[model samples]
Target: MPVPSQRYVRNHLLSILSPDDYEAIQSVAEGVALGRRDILIAANKSITHVYFLESGIGSEVAATPEGRRIEVCITGPEGIVGVPLLLDVDRTPHETFVQIEGDAVRVEATAFRRLIEERRLLRGIFAHYAYVAHLQTAGTALSNGSHTLEERLARWLLMCHDRVDGDEFPVTHEFLSTMLGVRRPGVTTAIHSLEGAGMIKARRSHVQVLDRDKLKAAAGDSYGVPETEYRRLLWARR
Candidate 1:
């Protein structure tokens, strides 16, 4: 399989790697396309391969026996999906899936583990990302519990906006409700609220961000800590 060239690698964790380090990993990696609803990691199942997403969005979701699902974290090129591989763990309780269609460069779990073990920088980079994922989870909890529905929606959209390529993206009331752990009607109400405020434009199955700064103001303090920390820790090394 051809490894993505250094100039073409999109995964943030992979792109910032020193050339020699990048080559070390790329030599073992192969690119795979991921589609909407593709299950990347099933709960409690051994993760066989780890993906460094080249483009698109993935979600860390938790579910109940009653079938209620809520997204706890989101990742794109900025993050990696399989962290259990780095922690000496075989599986995780959370299920990860692609929220939007995209592609990734993946390597066997054991191979990745070995590479990171032999290289301290790779290990530290992933560890730092895990910390950032944690902070994102904390932010989600704060948003879900304390913020109003409209504010929560704004925060969620902002996070998605960070992951994709452009201002407009495909989304639906059903998807938003599932990710937000709310009823479809409630999600629709929030969407209208934001749209009316001119922060976004929502149509049948897509949303276009009209004013990101305004959206941030609506999300208040719920959206930036993890992002700021990502810049501080990851970009500093880059």
Candidate 2:
């Protein structure tokens, strides 16, 4: 198969690869369209492929036996979806799915594993990304335990904004509640609070960031730690 042109590769993780490393796996990579709610990885299921998002967002979620699900981390173009593959695991305990409609570059799991084994830099990058992803998960846990609902909402909005293209993005109270592990009423109330504060504009199924600085202020110390760590670990290395 023909390799995709560099100009067409928007995924930050793929873009940062050295030319040789990028080409090493390029022939096996295929572009795919992702829909909202598309399951990329199902808990305990053997992963068939690994995805590098070109746009949109995905959520890593944990579920209870009762089927209650809550997002543990959000991934965008900056990261890959199949972390278990990098860790030499065939299945993951958590599920991952697209939160927004977008496109991705996907490669068969076997091909990806072969590339990782052959490329030292690619292996190092995946390891670094996995660490960054873990930090994000830890930050989410800490914020949920310590921060107020409004503050957590602010932090989530900021994270979403960083991944999306513009000030506005498609989201809903139900979705927000699911991601934050809160009730819908609580998310509704928090949205109103942020809207009243002029930090954001809430529409029927979307939220627009009006003032990111104010949003960060609302989030307090619950936000930025993981982001800073990402820049330090990945951007510096890049």
| Candidate 1, residue 99: lDDT | 89
What TM value does model 2 have? 0.96
Candidate 1, 1-238: lDDT as tens digits: 3668988888889988888889999889898999899999999899989889988999999999887889999999999989878888979888999988899999998899899889998889999999999999999998899999988999989999998999998899999999999999999888999999999999989999999999999999877999999999997876
Per-candidate clashes come to 0, 0
Q: TM-score winner among the candidates?
A: 1
Root-mean-square deviation per candidate: 1.0, 1.4
Worst 10 residues of 1 by lDDT: 1-10
Score residue 145 of candidate 2 by CA lDDT.
98
Per-candidate Cα lDDT values, in order, are 0.91, 0.91
